[model samples]
Each structure stands twice: as C-alpha cells, then as structure tokens.
Target: MRSATESQKDSAVLAELIRTLESWKETVVIAPDTPDADALASMFSLAKAFGDGDGRSAKVSLPENSLSQRLAFLHEWANLPVATAEDFARADGFVVVDTAKKSRCNLREDVPEDWDRGRTILNIDHHASNTRFGTVNWVVGEASSSAELVYRLLQAWGWPIDPLYASLLYAGIHTDTSGFSLPNTSKSAVAAAAELVERGADVVELGERLCRSQRLSEFKLLRTIYANTQLAADGRIAYSTADYQEIADAGCSAADVDDQVSVPRSLHGTRLAMLFTEGVRGKTRINFRGDSGVPALPLAKAFGGGGHDAAAGAIIAGPVPEVVAQVLPEAESYLNRLAQKP
Candidate 1:
C-alpha cells in the first residue's frame, strides 16, 4: 500500500492534469510503438471523448502496420484518417500514454518537426522508470495501469464513459495485469475491473478476443520460443532466443510477439526469465521477468533498460548471440545477489 503522503501527492498531480486539459483546444495522443491493449485502450478513451463536435479536437497517432492483429479492431472502430498531418500541424498539445521515455513512443517521420518541444506534453504512465519527460507528468508506478488512471481522470473531468470506453478500459487493465495473475495485480485493480464490468464492459468477449485470439503466425512463433528455451544456474534462470530467420520462417513480424516472453517466465522454479529476439540482424530486444524474490528493473537497468519490478525490456545494438552473452550472466548475477540479500 502506498503511504498517505504518496497518495496525497498523486491526487495533487491529478488535479493539475485536469486543470491543464480544461483549457487545451487541440491535442495529439500518442501510444508507443508495438502498443499493447493497455496503451491503445487508454488512448482510445481519451481520443474519442474529445472528438466529435467537442471543441477539444483530440487526435491519436496511429502508425502504419504497427498494431498487432488482435488489436486491429481499434483502427477501424475509431475510423481514424490515414494521415492527420493537418491535425497534427494544428494541434496545441500532445499526450503520451503507457510510455516511459520519448524514445519508446513512435515518433515517425511524418510527425510535425516541432513535436517534441513544439507545445505542451502530458506524460501519463504506470512504470517506475518513467523519466518525467513531459510538460506535466503523472507517473504513478503503483497504479494498476494507465487505463485505470484514465478512468479516474474521465470521472473527475465529468466526461461520460459509455459502454465503448468502458470496454477499452477493461481491455487495458485485463492485459496489463496478465489476467490478474501477475504480481502487480492489487485490490484496487480488482475493484476497478468489477466496476467496469458493471458499466457494460463485455468481459467474456474482451477475454475471448484479447487472450484466446492468436493468428497462425503467432502460434508458429510460440513454437519457436518454446523450442529455444534454455536453462541456466540450475534452473534459477530460464531464457529463450530467436533470430530474424526463425521469426520470418514462423511468418510472424516483430509486432506479432505480444507475450512470447511469458513462455519462459512461466517456469516453476525460475527466479529470472529472459527472452531475446534479434531484429533484422541489427538490434536485439531483451525482455526480463522476475519472480517475487527478484526485481526485473535492476537487471534491465544494468544493461541500460527500464521498466517495472516484474517486467522490463531493452533493445541493445548486437546480434542475438552477442546480446545473449552480455545479458545472461547479468541475469544470473542479479538473482544471486537477491538470494544473498538478508
């Protein structure tokens, strides 16, 4: 539980955020690259609420072919334009959801040249490692997810969250908490989810679509991830690796790897789990998951990455093997250090 002091601080920050949005005319909400349901859902609620005859004129940045197959419904549902160059050019502010740093969000070439410093930036996230890279930042790592935060924000702003927005919020919380199986799941998260279901969020359909829906190529990649699994330090460390060829052969794109890292992290005795994927033989992406006794962020930071205690990731410039050699020992040592902690 967060201390009273921390809760009060968060409340104050939220008040300021509401004040800022009250006067904003036009804005762009950006979800990071390879956005999961949480980021996209939060963006959906904020964007649609401000759209229509509403003078706010909030638009979202949708990257081409960046969304995974499961989340493609969002694009068509929103009926977003192919290019919002004119809207972006005229936007008075920018907002980013579920992203820790500027580098993490998709800053495509089509974005306005002054995107970074051109106007007000609102950074909202639930990661402990957030850099506060916004004109106003509300980085509450203890929050269940940014969707939860957005829910509260809409309520405070007196905006009506109908069934459509409720479903989006439910999707965000459901995915980020790993269906309430993850360590980050809290009592408040459960309460919020229950409330959303009461608000007509179709729990069964969202679960069926987000969890059970997987394309053929995604299934093939899962097979490769399982086959590549390796054990180290007497099973204290479980890791897997896949290069570009394996991914291509599986007919899966990089964005298709939604939760493949969860495969290694599911081992019974693993204190630390890692998944390494090489992107086009150029940069390798590493994902980390730590058991309760371990914290994943420190291990991620040791190699210049940042994320939550239970999950984190980094993209290092090296081939798969090279990156693996550098990360494995660090994972092993991190677990060892935690084991020795009194």
Candidate 2:
C-alpha cells in the first residue's frame, strides 16, 4: 500500500477518471492489440464497473484476432464485445488500459491520430516506460499489474465486485507477477489478490489453467528453444531464435513460444534472456527477460518497443537471422557495460 501522501496523489488521478466516466455519455475501452491477461482484465473491469448503471455502458475496442483460450471461461472474457475502427473513431472518449503510448495500443495509425483530437483519453498502466499519452494519465510504475490499479479504483469508487470481476482481476495479477514469483510482485498486488480470493475468485482453477496446464505445442517449442539457446557477453546474456517454419515443424505455433523466453534467464549464469520469433507479415517479435542487475527497458526502447524494466518486447521488420545479427551485438555490448559497473 502507498503512504498517506502517495495515496492522496493517486486519488487525485483516479478522481479524474471517475469524473471523466460520469460526464461522458458513451466511452470506448481499448486494450493493446496483443493484450495479456492484465490488459484484458483492466479493460473488462473498467467497462463493467463504469458502464453498469442506468443508461451508462462502454464498448470495448480490441483486435478481432486477439482472443486466447486461456481466459475464455470468465464471463467478462466471453461476453465482452469487440470493437471495430468505426467504434473507436466515433466514440466520445477512450479509456485505454495496460498500454502506455498510443502506438503501443497497436491500433491503426489513423485511429489514434483521430482519437487524440479534442477527445478524452485515459491512459492507465503500470509500465515504468509509459509515455503518459493520455489526457489523464494514471500510471503507477511500482504496481504489479494494471489490474492491481483497477482493483484499487473499484474499491475507491465503491463499484460492484462480483465473482466474475474478482476472477478476472485475479488472473491479471497472477499471470503478470508469474504467480507472485517475479520481482514486480508487491504488497499491494498480494493484498488485491487476497481480496479477490475473498470475493470468490477461483485461484485454484486459474493456477491449473495458467501455470499447470501446457499444450504439446508448448513442449515442442521448449525443445526448440533449448536446442537453439546461445550464451554471450561472458555468459551473462543468453539468446535464441525460432522461425515460423521451425515452430511449425515442431507441430506448434508462435503462441507456444511466448512464455519460453524467460526460461534461459533462470539459468545460474545468465542475467538476461532473449528470444526472437518470426511473426506474420514479415515481422520478428523479440521477448526479453532480465535479472535485477540487467534491465530490459533500454533494449526494448532501442527498438521502438516499450515495457517494464525486467520484462519487455519489441517487433522488428525481419528476416529473423538478420534481426538476430543486428541485435546480438547490442545485447552483448549492454551486458558488457553492466559487467563493468560497480
């Protein structure tokens, strides 16, 4: 929890969000195109909490292709309607969650440009790298997940928190903190999680689905990652690359590789881990995981990406090999500098 002084500061920003919701007739809640559990949870919670009263409802704008089976059980996940560009363009205002900059939202370039003019955009997130692109930006870098921030907002506003909302929020906190194992896990995050459990969030089921459950595809991808892993910068940096063809040959898809990047970082000698995977439309997606001594945000920002200090990602136009060749030296150089630090 924040001190009394910090709480007051947070209240001021949240108050603006509450006021903005009350004054707007129609609002659009937007999450990043490739949103995680935290992003989806925040979007759903804000939409449900703010739009539930008499004649007040918010539409959610998300990419049609963004849904994942991992969260399909939640009512909020299954029922929340997806929005088109038209909905985004015509909405009176936007409540953007779990994303910092407008570009990171991954909406069409024209959509954000149009939405930015004379419109109210609430940029809410937990990334230290947030650019505060919203008219009312409420960013808490120390918060574990955006869902944790949403939980506080719900409590402050006296909004309804049923089992569905509680479960969604729990999933956000649970996954983002790697089941409370990551360094970002905070007391506030743990407290929020406890409240969600009290409200009947199914923590057991969430664990089974998010942590225990894994597909054969994921195992296949893991094999590829292990086989291809390489070490550099005096073994402080570990990196690997997987192309679409290699993943397909293993009978898996790109999604299976998403969580495998962190595997290398767990090695005793490694302080930073990287995984590059070929994405559709000639883009290569790079995922980074770092220890306390090695921050990933600078690497992400260097490639026009943004995320937290320990975990971040970027998408580069690629031939996967070329992208690897271009980034590997930079990664080594950064690690070398860290090695020389006092």
Candidate 3:
C-alpha cells in the first residue's frame, strides 16, 4: 500500500498520464533492449487502453523480428509491428514502459537522441533508477512491475481490462516478482495479481507458458549453467558463468536463460547470487540477486547498472573470467563490511 504522501504522488502522476492519453490521437509503445515479458505486457496493455471507442490509434513497436522461444506466442498474439521512422514521425506521443533510461531503449536507429523533446513522452516504469525523462513520468519503484503500474493507471482512467491484457499483466507480474519470491512483491502487487486473475486472466495457461515449461534449448543452457556454478565468500556468494560459445552450443540466446542465478541463490546461506553471461564479445552481462539485508542495486550501480535492491544487472566491458575475478572480490568486500556493521 502507498503511504499517504505516496498515494497523493501516485494520484498526481496517474492524472498526468490520463491527461496525456486523452490528448494523444496516436500512441506508440516501445520497450528496452531485449524486452522481457513484463516489458512486452506493460507496453501492450497500455496500448490496449488507448483505442476502445476513443478512435485513437495505439500500436506496439517490437523492432525485433522474433521473440524468445518461450515468448514466441507474442509474435502472433502481440500483433506488434517493427518500428519505422514514419511511425515516430506520425505518433502524437510515445510511451516507454519498463525501461530505466533512454540509452537502453530499443528504438529505431533514426529516432532522435532528444526524441522526448517537443513530444508527450510517458515514462512508465517500476525502476527507481528511471531518469524521469518523460514529460509525464509515472514510476512506481515499489510496484512489482511496470505491468502493475499499467493496471493502476488503466483502472484509474476507467479503461476496461480485456481478458487478453489481463492474462499478459498477470504473467508479467509473476515473472517480474520472481513468482512472488522477491521482496518487492508487496500486498498491493498480490492484490493487483488477484484482480487480474479474477478479471478473466488465464492463470493456468500463463503458468504453463511462463513457468511449467522450458524449451529444449533452455534445458541445454541449464546443464551448462549447472556445470559452471560456483560458490565464494564463505558460501555467502554463489555465481555461475556462461560464455558466448557455451550459450551458442546450447542453441540458446541470453533471454533463454531463466534467471539461473536463482540456482546459486537457493543455497541455504547465500546472501548474493550472480550469473555472469558473456553474450557479446568483450562484454559480460551480470545478473545480481540478493537476500534480505544485502542490497544488489548498489553493486549493480558500482558497475554502471541499475535495478531493484533485490535484483539488478550490469553489462561490463570485460571477458567472463575477468569480470568474475573483479566482481567477486567487490561482492565479498561488501559482504565483509556488512558483517562488520552493527
């Protein structure tokens, strides 16, 4: 639940978003690099809120030819089109959902650096580190996911929640909250989820798609993950590494790896878990998941990344071994310092 002050703030921002929607005739929705299920659902749900008898045109820009195999259904179901220069030039406004910064957006190459200028940009996100780049920013860092923010906004605007959008929102919330295992899965988040389910969301189908099933490629990656897993910092830290070749040999992309850090994190005494993936040459991506009293965001920020305290990531310019060597010590030092604190 929001504190009194936070509720007022939410009211103000939500009012701003509603005003933007009422004025916008054509809205374009976009997400960040390698958009996840939460990002996709947030963008699509917000898009659906645009056109119901309002005569407004709202479209989601995938900008990618394909989704991860797990999300393959979105190719047909999302009905998103690849973004083009004309789309941006013609859009009355744009909505960037679930992204923390402009640099991370998966916009077309022709999109301007100061694109938000002279435009009604709605920066709807649930990341505390969001730059507030939107003329109308509705960031709820305490919310489980951007999908939750969309639910609240649409509910406030009296936009009916279609069954398909409800299913997407529910799936988005579940994944972003790590199946409600994370600390950010608050009572309100759960309540929002319940409402989505009650509103005709297909929980059983979404569960099968998102959780109960994995692709053959993902199973291959899982074996590789298990083989590379390691423990450090007196078992307070657990980590795994997967290089480009290993992932390629597994017939999987980075998105196919299902938060494998959770494997190490499941250790009885682990305070921090990391998955170092070398998806691109000379660049290593790190996923950080932390237990209570151990903040993951600080470590991510130290490496020029950002997300929630319980879950965050950074893409560093280094090989897998070098990054692991560099990051593990910093993690250990941080844990050691925490141990010393009163």
CA-lDDT, candidates in order: 0.83, 0.80, 0.84
Model 2: how far residue 267 lies from native, Å: 2.0
Model 2 lDDT, full chain set: 0.80
User: By TM-score, is 1 or 2 better?
Assistant: 1
Candidate 3: stretches off by over 4 Å: 110-114
Task: List clash counts for every candidate, in order.
Answer: 0, 0, 0
The residue ranges of model 2 lying beyond 4 angstroms of the native Cα positions read: 1-4, 74-78, 106-113, 248-257
Query: What TM-score does each of the candidates earn?
Result: 0.95, 0.91, 0.95
Worst 10 residues of 1 by lDDT: 74-83
The residue-by-residue lDDT of candidate 1 on 1-342, one tens digit each, is: 879998888788888887877777877788887888888888878777656425667778877767888788766666655327777778777788999888888655677666655578889999999999898998989888899988987877778777778889989999899999898789888898988988888888888888888888888889999999999999989999889889889887777766788998898998889999974567888989888868899888888889899889888998899999988887777778888889
Worst 10 residues of 3 by lDDT: 74-83
Assess candidate 1 and give its lDDT: 0.83
Task: Provide the RMSD of all predictions against the true structure, rounded to 1 decimal.
Answer: 1.6, 2.3, 1.6
User: lDDT by residue for model 3 over 1-342, one digit each (tens)?
Assistant: 678999998898889888878988887888877777898888877876785536887777676533577876644565655557777878898999999987888776677766555888889999888888787888888889999988998899997787887898888899999898889889988999999989988888888988868888888887888888899988999999999899889898765654778878877888999999987778899999999999899999999999888888899998899999999999999889988999
What is the lDDT for 229 in model 3? 87
| Model 2 steric clash total | 0
**Which residue pairs of candidate 1 clash?**
none
Q: Ten consecutive residues with minimal summed lDDT in candidate 2?
A: 69-78
